[model samples]
Target: MFAILIKIKAMRVLRITFFLFINAFYANAQYDFEKYPSIEYKDYDWETVKSDDGVTHKVIVPDFYINSESLILKINYYTEEAKDSEIYISGIKYKEDIPYTPIGLSSLRIADVNGDGLKDIKIISYYMGNGLASLNVKVIYFFQQANGGFIKIAYEDKMGDNRLERDFDGDGNFEIITMKIQGHKNHNYWLFNIYNFVNGKIENVNSKENYPIMVQILNRETFKITSKLSRQEMKQYQVNNLENYNN
Candidate 1:
């Protein structure tokens, strides 16, 4: 009896290596809001206009513009908050209004965001002074392509403050609730994504009718990805890396 057939083929190779390590731990398990909502609409609550009678921005592109004597607190990104708004830019890089500030204290908007009919460019900023988590915010988008091209989506947050719920769900479209990071900070986690502008670029229409706006942006994310998914500095937040995003 060849040693009982080598202990029954080593117990059938440990049950096929524990069933392939439980299917690779549920396929890299992490990013769960009922399995990370893909996309869904019908949750719009915007319209609080007080658009500072002077510089209600809409950055028209006559080769990159943001006039109104080069704006500076002409609020209108949903009635600016978390440090009002300030903008100034003229034909970027070649300089004009002179300022591309970020890292906190900002607000700039231009619609058609991912709808693909063109028109896009958003810049939002708040503050935590980036001491590595504890209420950080910085959402940036610059999607616009019809050949003139410009697709630069961005997201950041170590704790909270990340949203751009324009027409959040009321179906008119536009949904982006941030706070998504990935790997290598002790394996990060916490993600909720639903990027738009499909047929030209920017995808990941994560769907299932967006499980209640991904449970209301991860229960109004302020340190709730199941409490930082066992925080080791929340290195477990993940959204689909349309090539591992950020910056």
Candidate 2:
């Protein structure tokens, strides 16, 4: 009887030890940006600028491109009086590039879009061809402070005119919306993409078809499909007044 009791206690200890081992391994397995292969930190031209909110930012434009069609922007964050934190953002051109005309960073905007009290970064960059074949891209990086550094939690990209963020659900959080003019210039239609921050990341909450001129209501919890206008029905409505449209 004594021997059996001792063996049972030993088995219980082994089970608890195994459980802890698994949890420790998983905690360390999370993505580490420093060790990531696709990201590299090299010498680059750095500029220091102060935003309207009085925060100092060190913008680093990489001297060389790790990938030909992509541009990496490494920004260091600082207080109104001191320089201290860092955030890295990158944008890639989807379409084939036109040779000789390199893509460049055109503009940058710093603001708090998510209502999370942290300042976010918005980049507007363009690639030019011979006037007709040019492409303009916009990228937004949302920041979250973790582990003594500011990390990019969400990213949204659009190959269109401009990027807009609004509180679509009236829930205090912002939703990123982008409008892309598809098809040829003569018979083109607008394609709108909506993204919401959910589950610690950005998620698409719209269908792939054209939506009608109706209010889109998103469920704040699930982030699942609630309702949207179908492509077939959207064709019947005509949008004549552009100024009245909610961007």
Candidate 3:
């Protein structure tokens, strides 16, 4: 009878262990898009335009901002078949006459993001309000060729004061990092976020909250958080510790 009781106890423990393992596995599963807010893309009227670079571009003016200088353009390319062609969405920038700093077209960068050897375009744009006191809104767009047109594979938007991009995990792909001020007045707090382009979307892989007097770093591989006092002001804080964070 005692032997039977021991066997029954062992079976119960096994069942409980199996159930817990299953629960844990599901809990730590990949991110669910349904749980987050759906992304909304702005509508624009696209027009073909010829630029000084001697390349024809498909351009659009998003109504989000009233500034006429805000324009989005795509670069066209001919495919290997010689008959088919495609266009890649380039960036948002100002016209040549605009006095403001030219960002989109003038500052376009080409890089191989997916290790596919094909160059992709990286466009970063910002909405600067009035003067120094106004908060700036930034948007990053990454585009690649698809279906005879360009598709944005990764994008990130933030109302932060600064941004950074680098390969944080020793991977060929770059990570988008942003630092935002969360509090008001002189008692501001810093919120740092690290985003990775994964499975066609830019996902928040890690985040840190730092006091105004210190800097926080995350290990790109393990995501272990660490902090140190730097006495850097909130707006002045940048990703200066890449060596400590990147794997």
Candidate 4:
């Protein structure tokens, strides 16, 4: 009789614990959001700016591109002083803006690079030192789809000055346009590369200097490396109205 009574008590305790757990989860979820009361797409003014360590931040909303599949909004912003920065997104009628947790970024620009009608975000950050210094740390982060949430693609640390993304071969995917430096600003050149995503990894197909800065899509299963285009070469391409010569 004692054993049966003990079993009943254990069952009662388990039931109570389960009910408490569900109640707590629901309560927390309900209280997660603030009571803003209304939602609109208005630009937030510069929240803070100071000069002790020289911190500046500004946000501007550029254009809203509405396609048949998705609504792409471009956000342009910069931060001069702060350890952490945030970017917020919201719908035209929703009161809550979704804050994307940033990783290794301070300021950024969003645009549609390949004319695909999809927005890609680019971020640039400078490294902090002991005292004061002036240097630019540029990183190109591509936004891609994963499950239901969007993600930034480039994971390599500290990219260069300028970057362009396009389908270098005739394939339907995009690769990175990396500008490499030989020796600082004076002796550097640009190289356009072709990348292939295979086995869940980004790998380079073929990369060489002197390739045109233009967006060259893959065609007929291969892409050729053309002569390198200098900064002057880019000017000539533009002057002669040459297609696929330079960006």
Ranking 1 against 4 by TM-score, winner: 4
Give stretches of model 3 more than 4 Å off.
1-106, 114-116, 131-135, 145-149, 153-163, 184-186, 207-247
Rank order (by lDDT, best first): 1, 3, 2, 4
Which regions in candidate 1 have their CA more than 4 angstroms from the true location? 17-21, 28-116, 121-138, 142-155, 158-172, 180-247
The ten-residue window of minimal lDDT in model 1 covers 93-102
Tens digits of per-residue lDDT, candidate 1, 1-247, equal: 9999999999999999998998877556543333322333222122223434422333333323222233122223322242334332333221112112323334355666555455566665454454444355555565656654455555554443234443444454465545444443354434455555455445544453342122213222233344423433333233445432442
How far in Å is the alpha carbon of 104 misplaced in model 4?
A: 14
Q: Indicate the TM-score of model 2.
A: 0.40
**Candidate 4 lDDT by residue in tens digits, 13-93:** 999999899777655542101221111113233333445543334444445334224433333223332323333433222
Best by TM-score: 2
Sum up the clashes in candidate 4. 8
**Per-residue lDDT tens digits of candidate 2, residues 12-40?**
99999998998777555421111212211
Q: Candidate 4 has which clashing residue pairs, if any?
A: 39-95, 169-217, 169-218, 170-217, 170-218, 170-219, 210-227, 210-228
Candidate 2 steric clashes: 0
Q: How accurate is candidate 2 locally (lDDT)?
A: 0.41
lDDT of the candidates, in the order given = 0.43, 0.41, 0.41, 0.37
**Comparing 1 and 2 by TM-score, which wins?**
2
The per-residue C-alpha lDDT of model 3 at residue 105 equals 27
- Give per-residue CA lDDT, model 3, range 1-247, as digits (tens): 9999999999999999998998777555422112222222233333444455333435554331223233355544232231232333324322211112223222444455544333444544343446533344334344443322334532223443223354545565555555444443444344555556556555655432232222232232111122333434432544433211211
